[model samples]
Target: MEHQIDLTVEQDPSRSYRLLPEAPACGPRELTVTLRSSARDVVEIAMWSETGLLPQPRAASHHARLTIGADQIASLSARLISRWQRFVQFEPVSGSNRLREKKPYLHNANLTVRPQSELLAQVSELAREGAYLLGELLAGEERALVRFRGHLLNVLESEDLRIRFDSDLGVPWPMLAVGCERLLEGGRLTVDPFRLFLGHRHQVESTSGTYPDYWWVSDRHHAVGSANLDKDLKNVPLADDVLKLLNSRLKDLNVRHFSDKLLPDLAQPVLDEDVMYFFCHGSYEEHGGRTWHALRLSDELPIDAPLVDGYRKPHTDAAARRNSVALFHPLVVLNTCFAGAPATTGFTGLSAAFVRHGALGVLAPQIAMPQVFGAEFALRFLTCYLDEGLTAGHALLETVRWFATTYRNPLALTYGLVCGLDSRVVTSPQEGTTGS
Candidate 1:
């Protein structure tokens, strides 16, 4: 897919250009940004991907920067945003390649910049900016900054402008807001992330039996002894409330709830459902020199299916199996801590595993989040996804917006969409027809 944004100084007052893509780019895209200026005053251009995830710069490139001629033609590569990933920075290049000869400058200054110190400063600035934005958005409420770093894009610059993105994903808000704040604070021109997570309509196929449309699973009960007693002790009634909400709002949809007994069933594919909601404790464990994120079922058992037999094997020996069967394709909502944590090698976290195994998308937290916040966000997200018929990415973005507005907490950024950014649980009649 390709998108074009024409930015004229006169029409856009804030000089903030918003590029709302019609749909999410299924693959790489070419984004042409045309800046209309009467005089060639060096305009600093910054690009941000609102979906949060941005492609890393190539080895041959210094930073994610592109140079375009006065003709307003530039070839740039774009990637769709996945869950848990946030923020992207790109440098706009102009003129000849010889310009790379100049020393790197800090914030348009001629002074040579040290990489480490500059990164720290950028992180701090982003943190402060994020907190301030949340404060303003939430009416004087203060929030702590989620940690982030400033990645230097290796691009030769003929001008002193940059483009940064602030995504709705919880942790990177400060970084994105800081990038936006720079433009607003300095009165520089800016651009919104052009790549989007497009929405696709789904058809509910009828099966022979009354299969569930949504599955609510929780592990409120643990065995006699558990590794993390504190988590087990502090029981937040998330699944129950979420179940009530889903049942009440989505009366036409089949919703089912399960507890500890259903952990074994998870080993099998969830063929009959559209959504799987898991409210439990999750963590990363090292076995056979590989780290895996597992959700706790009982004190002695985790959702490491590769290690266990059909609920018959001893928990001690389950570690020997490395390749577990993947879950059936469902939009999985993992309301647990560290379920979305990135892996050191392959996709290791619970959310990543789900995606690897054919799950449409996984909504999980990058870090440990408060139970109350998690439940509330889940409620809002489901409402938007099922009732309002929004795509997973939009639903998450809406939920984060509400959280930021209501609590002024940057922690909302911690929750991420792992994949299936364009997925929706319910298909409206019109959307169904169009999709068909």
Candidate 2:
């Protein structure tokens, strides 16, 4: 049996609705409900199977219910068409992982509905059913329908969603997706899958400054008995390769391949650098009962102290004081394991400390990252951003796409971007003039 109910209550701000229909007391019972709303305004709807009819005592048994809001339907349709467009674009191209050069599909769309907790929960459930349903919804084949997955819905907060495309949809097979809850209503929203690009053009315009230079800091050596040597011994060559690549492309680039150096000395050049790349070992250590994420430096010095100090006024000589002030905010890339994990205390970790100082953003791994994949990702990311003039976020995303497609490895998703989502770093003319 099918039932329709109007859930709009004058007192409630969300314009929510609820539907209840009668069912038999015996055997198995199946009921379907269809919700209707005006097309003028986008409405978000959520539904769940209730144990009993209205005006009756509620039963303990509950089942997953189909909730379809007007806005969700429209949004799903739009996203499907956009994905299809991207798939079509990649069909003709070979050996290129770049997204088609075109305007984003969600550039002008307005999202009216706020994703409440319940709605987010439903979306989480939808993602678990595999990508077939979402693909179908995106294809615009279903107007409104419900399916019974025959399991109790596990109520868990959605952290991330993974969608895998069937073979029928060629290439770019699986996607690791995240949802943005707050968007400008009656404002433009661009559909850049994965939110990969940082739009830092405004930051550049506001400061009236040219793009910053590059600084690559690498530590290939560790103490004789250091625990990190076993895990990170292979990353030394990778770091060297990265340094060479940057030197070849960037004009005002500085490379510091250090061993047995203090934190302040190693971090001095980083104060004025525009882009800081660290290729070393990282770990989370519990010291004095407090956890900290530290990058292992060549001098066997943990970077935790410098990060704790952050950017502070120098109390020493005139030269030290003058150099203490930063000229440009850097975008730091910590190409090491566990660099992205948050510390137990205030602004902890190498990545967070850089951001706390004056960095525009930090790209680090949330867990122990494979050295091979890390090297590949770092090389491609820097190439795209420095050579191709792609934003840091976009470059990271493109590199991840290439890595994922090439190796069929989803480990790229482990790398996280913290802050500086819209920052861009371009090569300056002065640096351009003095090419290698």
Candidate 3:
């Protein structure tokens, strides 16, 4: 019964999904959702697929199109952030304990009355609403997801979902929960909210910025480095454990710890390391009428967008035309708040800077997170990707699901990905090796 196809065949097949005349083709295993600015308070969503979104062999081959009020999505993103921050711990429990306190409290949130149930319902409603909007191409745009997922959208059973939001506003695609309160066509219900969250259910990534040069690393060992910018978190046992894992678990390991360097030191041609970790605080500043996101390590000055762009932007067009690009594009793990869900998808944040210049992918929390969870999340992700040999996308998706199921903590959903859905660690960094 669980695998039963919950088909909601379109009453009016005319409105069903269809492929566009010139819609480009992508891999059958992949789906791309693009959100672009349309007009005031409106955004256009386009879903492209090669094998069609439905499950049947003769499924509608048309691309999906929908226009949603930008404000609605913006509100949903804010609500998701507010929900987790209020119920779950965002900052470290204590400044001194930095990374010592480790516990998953998503189920009860340490609350005796168990308000999680209500919040779960709310999150699922948000998820349902999101699906309803995205599924606007279906015959019945107003139908619940449970009635359509089995035959319409190829989700839950698959995790390869790539999203590109070219608008100024960034949506938290992973945190949106779906169908927790809905009954399927067979009258079966999925009341478990943890499993319904998009981030936990799918390997979703939001990417923007110019494509990086397809440069390769000719080295044999994968270089792993981390920066502990905050003194409070610098000496934590978690950091030590991570460093040890990078050394022992990975073959031909190259582990390094970066110091609290200033802009000049960071500006040089010395951004080397395939896997970069940062244990620091994300800072935000308003400059030139735009929010310039920055990162602070220890007491050093903030590494903001402008500073990063000066050195991080991809090679000049002329250089790129000459086939000259960074020897290796790194996968950056920023355990900082607002790093993943940037204030703007434009070149206004450090994540954007790295993606624009060169990065396999950048993973970071969309909002402020508990220090304990941040440390643990980083460890789990790196362990899965570097040691377990999972792609960056799978590593992230599995980690979030693990946390939500094992610890009842859904904070992992707060972390978002920019590019690198298929990024994975390599044993030999051959110039031809391409997993990022």
Against the true structure, whose lDDT is highest?
Answer: 3
What TM-score, computed on C-alpha atoms, does each candidate reach?
0.46, 0.44, 0.71
> For candidate 2, lDDT tens digit of each residue in 1-436?
8899878766732111111133212221121122234352423222232433212214323222234444454444335333433322222222576544332211211111322332223223322222443333223222332222211111111212211111111111122222332222364333222232111111110011121222222111110000112233444446556666677665446544444333454345324455677777776667667666777745465666354454331321233456432433567788776776432333335654555455667777655565665676677778877677675656666666565345333345455565554555545443211111
Ranked by lDDT from best down, the candidates are: 3, 2, 1
Residue lDDT tens for model 3, 1-436: 4787787876633211122234223223345555665564554444445445544333333233333466666565666566656546422245676754333343232222334554454445545654554343233353332344334344443544543333345777776555544524375445665666677777777765456645343224454444444666756547667667666654434332333344443454445556767777775666677665667776657776677776554343434677555433568888877777643532566776777766778888887666666777878888898777787888988898787666656678888888777676554444223222
Task: Name the weakest run of 10 consecutive residues (lDDT summed) in model 3.
Answer: 14-23
Model 1: per-residue lDDT, tens digit, 1-436?
8889887676532112122234334322111111222223222222323232333333321122222221221110001112112221312234764443232321221112334334334334434444343333223111211101122221101111222122111122211232233333354323221100110111111011112122122111110101111235235545455666555544233432333445444444323345766666766667677766666643546664343233323321242253332225467788776776442222334554455445567777765555666666677788888778776766766665565445433344556565555566543333321111
**Model 1 residue 121 lDDT?**
42
Candidate lDDT scores, in order, read: 0.40, 0.41, 0.59
Evaluate residue 13 in candidate 1 and report its C-alpha lDDT on the 0 to 100 scale. 28
